[model samples]
Target: MRSRAIFLAGALVMVALLGGVTANSVAAATKTTVTWKLSSMTAGQNEWLSDLASTNSPGVKTWSKTGSCRFLPEGFKGFLSMGTGKSCTLTLKIAKSGKYPAKTATHTIIRAPSPATTTTVTWKISSLTAGQVKNLSDLAKTNSPGMKTWSKTGSCVLSPKSDPPKLTMGSTGSCTLTLEIAKTSKYSAKTSSKTMILALYGVGDTGPAGGTIFWVDMTRPEGSQYFEAACAGWSDRTCGFDLNEGSRDRLATWGCAGTPITGADGTAIGTGEQNTIDILNGCEDSALAKFADRLVLGGQSDWFVPSKDELSQVWVRREAISGMPGSDENYLSSSELSANLHIGMNVNCYSGCYIHIQKENNGYFRPIRSF
Candidate 1:
């Protein structure tokens, strides 16, 4: 009976030992370990860590592993992932070196030992540089909370915006004005600008003056008659004036002569001025001379139709006075070529020739006044 009791006690002890061993084996099957091998990363560089693991016993079924990184410093980010083979990798990259001394981050690894059980391991990462810190500070300063702002550089200036500006052309006979743009602290300078031109003119010149200079002579002697004497049958015809008559004779025989007369300037002499005045005075408001008589230019009231010589001078300088040459229009002169014909000049004449149209023929009229 004592031997039987000893066998039973031994069997009970064996059973307890086996139970303890079975408990230890189950604990070992579910146990997992995770570890990180990196402590810091450099700025502007990539860091890779492949030493992370989620190890478990072969008895553990349906296990999964995952890794993640968070709370990284400014300008820094990290990635972590677990592969199908139960291995984990952490990758870190720095986009910019911002203004900061050092940055801190947390890396976490999760291991699922079973469908309903999980274990997590966490650690800290610290890495940053002075230059990166400075950069980050600058970015923050430019983009503050209250109102964000930025800076840029460039310049622009306009002198006359509403009206045309005037410039005096000195003795050099030319004038110029400029429009410019400049560079500011934030902008670069520009090389292109606008330019304006100012035409030149003489002091006593009249009419549309620019590009070239011209003058009209007002050297008529005092007390000269504005018209010739009354004559019949020559209303539309010349009063017998010749082209070669001298200025003195043309002036003395104003009522009877059709002469080519000239002034001291070589083109202002002729009897046409007197003839036009006489015709207009006789006919009152019906004559072309009335058009000249009514003209008031530059505050002068004594304008007259030009003589043949005067018209010639105007034609020669037409470009300077009007910015363009005279058209093919015929202009009347006060001189008479014959008893039935009145003298006229063609502005577009190539050889500066004279013409005789009927006294009543229509022509363009340009009045002149002495300055």
Candidate 2:
């Protein structure tokens, strides 16, 4: 009985010892360890990991570990890698400041052959200056090619992860934007801004004739008069007329020189139509004059042929005018150079030069009204 009791006590002690050893072994196996340190950093700047103190536990193969590094609030790129081995001399660069309120980056380390065992180290990033923030914000607002408007929504920013930032337009409009010029070896940093305006049209002013106010007759008095196209069309010469005396007359002999004539009598809007009609009255077959006399548009019958200068204004503001004939075609002007020929302007060219065409030929016509 004594021997059996002694044996039972020994067995109980052994079991207790074995249980303690097993518990200790399990604790050690589940323990996580990582030996890397990082200090705060500024955006758009580069730094080396070796500058900070780092180490590995004794008998631990840190080089065989795989992990990734990333910044919070997203949009941070180029700071992560997955591989074995401790990269003591690894380099890190943060391109742009991330979204507001948070600027933390996390580095995750996982044990090789068993990713279940892992650890993480977090580091903070310094916020950008007010100027830098503003510059980056402006760069975000820059317009891209084929964009026609400006956008004010969304946080505008440049990512430092990308060496050169890209700009794009968010909406359509003609507006101004400021941009930041990054620092380079050749040039110091600076700010650049530009205003985009429609070529001939001002913002929101449709002209006096109730159409898009494309061009302002700078030479005319304020509200004195402006011209608008009655409609967009080509070749209304069902009835043609002689340009000069015969079928052809030199501009030198015709009384229509020094054109773009405004006022009454063939020069002004209404007078110009009358003047062409009077000159071509006897011909009865005059093409341009007859076309102008029979024209009507915009619920009004006061439409007439524009003078050479007036036609030139249309050319100058063709982009803003909506329906001026294309540059590939030519249109007739009331200014006559000869009996058989009349002065015409190419709708595509804005220089206002005169081209002569036969009076009998059908050409483009965009009748005009004045107010």
CA lDDT, every model vs. true structure: 0.38, 0.43
TM-score per candidate: 0.30, 0.33
Q: What lDDT does model 1 reach?
A: 0.38
Model 2: lowest-lDDT 10 consecutive positions: 120-129
Deviation from native of the Cα of residue 164 in model 1, angstroms: 38
lDDT of 2 by residue, 138-231 (tens): 3343222222222222223334333343333223333344444444433344444444221232312454334444333423444324456543
Backbone clashes in each candidate structure, one number apiece?
A: 30, 29
lDDT of 2: 0.43
Worst 10 residues of 1 by lDDT: 123-132
Per-residue lDDT, model 1, residue 35, is 44
| Model 2 residue 48 distance off true place after TM-score fit, in angstroms | 76
